[model samples]
Target: MGELANCPNCGELFVKGAQTVCQNCFKEEEAKFEIVYDFIKKKKNRTATMNEVSEATEVEKKLIQKWLRQKRIQPGSFPNLTYECERCDTQIYEGRLCLDCAETLQKDLQQTDQPKTLKEREDENKREKVYYNVDKENKWRS
Candidate 1:
């Protein structure tokens, strides 16, 4: 069962599902996306940059950036199409962040999901042993 939600774009109450916005807004976005796609697919504009395409299509830069992140724009065909990395703001052809940022993020994640080995649990259980000499005064009481 879907819950009622106020569309973020139009504030109209809508059944929440895969879409964040209402039907009207979704249709508008689809139309805008088609316009952007048609503009970029033109042979003369195939190699155009994001800003160039945005200016020509008269669409918001963020909307085009969203398409790039969604992988709707192919870098192989449009080599100049690039989006900013979410972390470092570096130009990347795909994904939310660049490769370097992604690696650092992975390293920062704690490995609590990994199970402890038998040797590791045993080491934690062992305590340091101490030896006491009762015959310290008697030098060679072997």
Candidate 2:
């Protein structure tokens, strides 16, 4: 066993072993953990952005990310869990927006299932006019 450290909750001496703190402090921590876990476990709570979790749980985002890295919480179990991009309001699984967003602005480029714009129609007409003019010029020269 390692030397005792002061309990963060009660400032009491706690041995360094399986316990993070003294029994009383451990119990308090356990209770807090359960509260957070339960809040996240609800089906309605399936998807939680980092900001949302921070606002709801009152836990720091950095601390939550740390916990995730440590595997204290299994992200695999939470499929809908996502984080928002600082630049865009895109939902992302890990750090920021989805991989496609990182690569390019696919959402912006996705063609809408609608009619073509006036400019497109005008461009097509111009091409037809040009072809007609070329044929007329050829016939006059011949």
Candidate 3:
């Protein structure tokens, strides 16, 4: 027999490998899951968009996207389960992190002017491109 674990939702005892509630409670969860899955599966639902999923399921958009990327829900099965960024709310189909967030973070990181000696700057300049922050924008300055 497998080790025991407390159900995440109801705190009942279940097998250790289970991450969610036990089988009895899982039925209730499955009902909700079916609602979401059904909503995503239908053609009208396919065009429903992330905002519609948020409104219908009350599940956070980010989490829906995570489920899609993790293959907990098959992409081919439901063609419309795409995730958007929590910050900018941009649609990102591939990964949990959005491209805009990545670009913004990259720009913010590059904006920090690290102090370096002339020789160090020259060596760095030789090895790679140099970026500078001007008017709150990142620009590659030669």
Q: TM-score order of candidates, best first?
A: 1, 3, 2
lDDT of 2: 0.66
How would you encode candidate 2's per-residue C-alpha lDDT over 36-65 as one tens digit per residue?
678778877767766777789876665555
Across 14-132, the per-residue lDDT of candidate 1 in tens digits comes to 99997778999889989999998898889999999989988998988887887777777777788888889999999989888899999888876646546689997778767444454
Error of 1 at 86 (Å): 0.8
Lowest lDDT sum, 10 consecutive residues, model 2, at: 133-142
Task: Tell me which residue pairs clash in candidate 2.
Answer: none
TM-score (all chains, Cα) for each model: 0.72, 0.46, 0.48
**What C-alpha lDDT does candidate 1 achieve relative to the native structure?**
0.84
The Cα error of candidate 1 at residue 93, in Å, is 1.5
* CA deviation > 4 Å runs, candidate 3: 57-66, 76-80, 84-91, 94-142
Query: Which has the higher lDDT value, candidate number 2 or candidate number 3?
Result: 3
Global lDDT scores for all candidate models: 0.84, 0.66, 0.71
lDDT: which candidate is best? Answer: 1
- Candidate 3, residues 14-73: lDDT per residue as tens digits? 986644459877786567667777778777777676678878987666556656776777
Q: Give the higher-TM-score candidate: 1 or 2.
A: 1
RMSD vs true structure, all candidates? 9.7, 16.6, 13.7
